[model samples]
Target: MTSNSPKVLVFAGSAREGSLNKQLAQLAAKRIEALGGQATFIDLKDYPCPLFDQDIEAQGMPDNVLKLRAILAEHQAVFIASPEYNGFITPLLKNTLDWLSRPYEDTPGLGLFAGKWAALVAASPGGLGGIRAMPLAQQLLANLSLTVLPQPLSLPGAGSAFDEAGALKDDATGQKLDALCQRLVDSLAKTHG
Candidate 1:
């Protein structure tokens, strides 16, 4: 990709070994690269931080949180595949976001996220496809000053959505993912141009 190509950080809220959200995130990263953008796919399991606490902040940010913030600061956009937990965002994601939203050193609170773009997707085995958590996730991102895309993808029956090759089994579902990645890439062009 060119230096001008959009750099996107792609990750999933769930870090379980066989998480459907993780599969979705991996697919998104590949699609982003195919569309000529750069995708930095990460696993939250690698950047573990404690639940957000003022006491911890007073001591100093965790090494992992600092590393994660640095990674985020370098990207122009983020693509998240969130898994729902009881009609809400996963606690891991919420805690991570909370930590990242804090001010560190000279950077202001939300500095890592403000004015950046974000796209969200979710996958679940149930019929709703984790749709119940989309609005909450969107609102949280917006509150951090990120401009979230309007059309979020929610993949229901995720257990069977992907083929053996890790590609979506449905043509229509694949097309939707392509469209979302295209929109993100196009938005970067518009903003950067």
Candidate 2:
């Protein structure tokens, strides 16, 4: 990657083993790297934070949350592969965002999110490909001051979407993902370069 290449943080909302969203996130991270951008692929399972609660916050911010916030702050863009749970974002993701939105030390509310860019994608076993969750996720990110990209990808029938190597089996679907990653990288170059 070059000095001006966008540094992107890539992660999925779900932590379940063999999760399709996780596979999608991994692919996105690779695509970003292939496009000459720096990608940091993280697993939420490694940075476990408790469910957001005011009582907990009143005491002190969780170390994991603080670590996550620091990681986010270092990236110019983020690529989120979320799994749709009941037509909305997963509780884990929402809770993590809630904690990240809270102020700590000299940082203001939503300080980590402000002026950052985000690209969202989803994969599901059913038809619609977790598309139902995209708008809600976008709104949540927007509320936190993130400029979400308009072009999002939702891969349906995720159970059979990938090959043994974890790459998408369908060429068309893979192309769509490529386009989304390209848009994200190009946007970063335009804004941060």
- List the candidates' TM-scores in order: 0.98, 0.97
TM-score of 1: 0.98
Q: Judged by lDDT, which candidate is best?
A: 1
What are the RMSDs of all candidates, in order?
0.8, 0.9
Candidate 2 regions with alpha-carbon error over 4 angstroms: none
Scored by CA lDDT, what does every candidate get?
A: 0.94, 0.93
- Backbone clash pairs for candidate 2 read none
Q: Model 2 reaches what TM-score against the true structure?
A: 0.97
